[model samples]
Target chain A: MIKKIFSLIIIAGLLTVFIPIILNFSFQTDLPDVAKSYVEKGSKDLGAMNIVTAIIVTFRGLDTLGEVAVLFIAATGIAVLFRKNAINDKRPKQISKRDSSEILLTGIRLLAPVILIFGIYIFLNGHLSPGGGFQGGAVIATVVLLLFLSDSSYKINHKIFGFIESFSGVSYVIIGFLGLVLMGADNFLDNRILPLGEFGTILSAGAIPIIYTLVGLKVGTELASVLDNMKGDIE
Target chain B: MTDVFIIVLGLVMIVFAILALYLKDLVASVIAAGVLSLFASILYLIMQAPDVAMTEAAIGAGLLTMIFLLAIKKTKQIEDPND
Candidate 1:
């Protein structure tokens, strides 16, 4: 009771500190100078329908690359930690996973394909939509999670995942370097290496779709591997 | 109208956050946290940030919840008072 009351008092104190700030917060009515420029010229310069995608993929592309690298490191860390446990426990223990309900199994069977297609669509049309590689990759990872839940014996091929991850990461960096080689230092990760097709179409947006596709694949594989690690050793 | 919706969502999120903090059942706490993420995503949508909303919903609500559940499965289902 004392703990609960103390927590409540803390919450009340936080509210007291924050409520005035919230009340006084005024929403920005106009874009700042940098934002104004991006909003005005982003679509024309980057050939992406979604300005947010244009900014993330081209205007600040290097940051996104760093973000992907961070995710890779995190996934690698999980794999390393779990690998240590697997090596330490040489005894094979009996693993028991409860059988999923019929409803869940049937639902997953029907929904998996649709979810897969949706994830692909999200990344493929990232340059034109609100979702990009990270979101789509996460959606794809959820499918892996679903499969794990539904089938206890299901195993992911680590070799294939590793290949996909390395291939995508390498290709992404190569494409970024291609922009530098073709244009200049200022054009690193520039999408203009390929022709920027019609503005709002799927084939448009120059290399944005390709970059996002690679990002999506790398992110999906990394997340799946993390999930696989957490699933523990089945054998 | 949008302000009202945002305010309601914020209140609900706070309620869930507190519930998550206080819940004894680990699964219930995880679910509460997930619900907070779901509400946050909705708030993001209302604020005209669809990209952030999608990422938050997929990652915060879905994957994080699943990870927490998996961790719980590997451990205990209830919060121990002493430990």
Candidate 2:
């Protein structure tokens, strides 16, 4: 009875909220003033075909940096929470390669490389395409998750993980620091330092793609590490 | 026409969300949540926000579901409705 009542109330609330969206009449079609200027000027100023990437990696770089820091903190927290259990356990529990079907293994071998290439392509073309660092990085993390799903005992090298994770984080800051030094502290994360090649290309967008690539590596490694710890805790 | 598709997808999302809440098995609930994310991503795509759709599909459906499943593996594999 309580479940029925609760569900009914929730459904009613959702319907009320979604009615406008369902009608599609309340959806704003015109771009706001700030967004209008961004779309108009962003392509020429930032040399990024994807104005969203320009907004995220250039205009709001400090915000993106802060966001990445928040993600890093969350990753650190998860690591710390599961640290003891992860360390004490030397071996993976109840996992056997033989337990998985041969077909799955064959599929993984054939599909893993494609997924990886796709993820790299997503990040590499972030300036010109819909994908950016966070999206691509998450896609890359899926590769590790896929491996874990197939074989719980799949081991990722801690050394490589740590290197990729830390290097990306440090390089992000280093690039920002370069901006501060070269273009003044107020200009931290400015994209004008490097040559902004042709627009709508992989090599364009100055530092946006580089920053996004670093962001992807950091996010991907961080998530993979978190998943690793959780997998460790499972008996 | 697009509205019809949007409404249908939205309904599917709500249904999956309800199924997630109603399910007894923790893993099933997590899978339901993944399906919900998938629908949400499709909605984003239909709305022309491809970046958001990609992120939702990858992180929401893929990464989060795996995390939840691992958490379920670590904790109670099954939920007890009775206190």
Q: Highest DockQ: give the candidate number.
A: 2
A1-235 per-residue lDDT for model 2 (tens digits):
8998999999999999999888876657799999999998788787989888889988899999999999999988988888765466766686444667889977987888899899888999998889989988888888888887786568989999999999999999999888888878698898877888987777887888899999999998998888888887447
Q: Which prediction has the highest TM-score against the true structure? A: 1
Residue-pair clashes per candidate:
0, 0
Best-matching candidate per lDDT? 1
Question: Which regions of candidate 1 are displaced past 4 Å?
Answer: A1-24, A84-88, A96-107
lDDT by residue for model 1 (A20-101), tens = 9999999899889999888777787778888899999889999999999999999988888778555666777886768888
Model 2 docking grade:
high
When summed lDDT is taken over every stretch of 10 residues in candidate 1 chain A, the lowest stretch is A82-91
lDDT of 2 by residue, B8-62 (tens): 8888889999999989998999999999999999888988899889899989998
Q: Compute DockQ for each candidate against the true complex.
A: 0.73, 0.81
Clashes of 1: 0
TM-score for all predictions? 0.91, 0.87
Docking class of 1: medium
Lowest-lDDT window of 10 residues in candidate 1 chain B? B1-10
What would the per-residue lDDT of candidate 1 be over residues B1-83, giving only the tens digit for each residue?
A: 87788788889999999999999999999999999999999988988999999999999999999999988987789889985
